[model samples]
Target: MNPDNREWERVDEKMILVMRLTGAGKSYFIQQLTGMNVSAGHELKVHILYLANFVAGTEKCQVIQTSIGNTDFAIMDTPGFDGTTRSDAEILKVITEQLSIIRLGYNLKGIVYLHRITDNRMGGSAMRSLDIFEKLVGEDALSNVVLATTMWGNVVDIAAANRRDSELREEYWGSMRRRGSTATRFDGTRESARAIVEQLLGKKAVVLKVQEELVDREMSLNQTAAGVLLELEVYAEAEQIRKRLEQLESELKYEKDSNKRLEVKRSQRRNAKAFSQCAEDKKTMKSKPGVEVKGKLKKWAESGGKIGLQALQGLAAIVSISFGIAGFILGAGF
Candidate 1:
């Protein structure tokens, strides 16, 4: 305190300040960034310093700190300051106290303004929070405010999602271009955490190896396993496409065959109707007496001639049977 009067090192110091609103996972984000277990009791020197008592013994603010790699950063978890609830006012007081403490005791680098990805509709709460941030940090602190969208793991499509992420960023800092506090999106997951960490460190993309976290066992059967996963996926997709195409072809063939059958039935019906009409016309012409009698004789022969000659033979047989019975009775009497 006597020798070095400066609170912070220099402008190019590797110190960072992470500030996010409530429920934005400020504590969890800091833990992930530093790869430290900042749980209830997880062997870490991280502690939450209540800033409320610093200003007034009644109110206090909470700040989370962790050392990421070689750099030491301060992560600030601010409470809701919308002044809508009694607890909110207390939290707002704590936030102001913490800001005062930072300005007086510590050197501020940049601020990460945490906003929920789901909270797309920016109402009065967000506006009031921004206003408080602006008033407490001043116009110069605008460059330090990093508009960070937290809970980004909930977003399915970062590019296609209908989230009001850009609107809020632009609306809040559209005029503060001089400060040049760039806005960035981050996913709240291990993969996203790694990516964000690399981006902050200005490093290249590093592939994280897949690690089995569950129970491990020694394999008794030593065999090399082939990766057919991609092949299986391709085969399944191709089979589905083939089945769909076959169904379409079968439907088209059925339609064509039905149409052909319908045409054949229509043609048959037309031919039968024409033949019936011609027969009717021939009957009409034959009804006149001037028509040839040869046609009637031909029809009688076509009836097999039994209709006329067979009836006559039956009458003759009945008469012969009656005579034979009478002759037999007379002979017996004589």
Candidate 2:
């Protein structure tokens, strides 16, 4: 658990749960929305983890107070479920515990889930996370949820992003919208974050599915739906790694090619590491008790290949040659 997590623990301030995958601007959004810097002479400030350039910046949960309209509200910032350093089980355990504690004290406005606008597709990890989120929120309170796409400034083509947004509205996130989850954009600005929060201010307060299950219903991790789903995923990963290892072993038995065997052996090693991690996670899940969840740039240097770079280079050569010839002919005529 974050040591400073409950430092600002109070009941009066209304709470909003903001979540996103790592590097999806979850912290940045919260930091901007609160408009409070670290110890800049403000009563409420968000503490951000200092990370190196290569690694994703955020690593923990921050619960802080920021006023929206005339009322002061508490915003609980969460780390991504797929974040590095901690296992998903550990992360979820800490988050659900903290949320449940807060829920007991005060009313929670709703959940706000953010996604990257530049992401071309909602991949497997994201989809699975969404499934767990649904189980966490439950069907009844899902209408209070907001599935907002963010980082609009990063995308060069607004039209392309709009098309993807429409698809999310119609197909990808269509079911969520139908169930009452509103789709919006963060626009990567403080104004956008405030606007979104304003809409949620003074809204209905509902108990999260996980909170009700664990706190009210007193359900164990295994008994809750989201917890069960995560356990199954851990088991599935282990099973998948085991099957691949068996397949590689069988292939090595019949194969005479030394190079191929070496490749398979290396693959087995990596899968072995992943399997070991998965097994440990499964153990943690069984032991712990929280039911909860959850680019196209055309530069040859970026392309790292001769195809696009060479294609552009070739096209440039052709254009140059044609222009050169035209200039010569025109000069001769003159």
> Which model scores highest in lDDT?
2
Name the lDDT of candidate 1.
0.40
User: Which residues of candidate 1, in runs, are more than 4 Å off?
Assistant: 1-18, 36-60, 82-89, 156-163, 190-334
Q: Report the lDDT tens digits of candidate 1 across residue range 48-96.
A: 3211112222322234443344544444444555433323323432333
Reference-based TM-score of each model: 0.44, 0.70
Q: Which residue runs of candidate 2 sit more than 4 Å off their true CA positions?
A: 1-10, 37-59, 246-269, 288-334
Give each model's clash number.
4, 0
Query: Candidate 2 lDDT, tens digit per residue, 1-334?
Result: 2212322223454678887776677766765676544332112322432211112232444555546556666666666687667777766665666555544445778889988889899888787777878888888878778888888889999899999889878887888899888899888677888878866775787778877776666566656778898888778888998999899889888889899989988988998988888877776666423222100112322445232211322322321211000000011111
Superposed Cα deviation of residue 300, candidate 2 (Å)? 59
lDDT values for all models: 0.40, 0.63
Q: lDDT at 14 for candidate 2?
A: 68
Question: Distance (Å) between predicted and true CA of 33, model 2?
Answer: 1.1
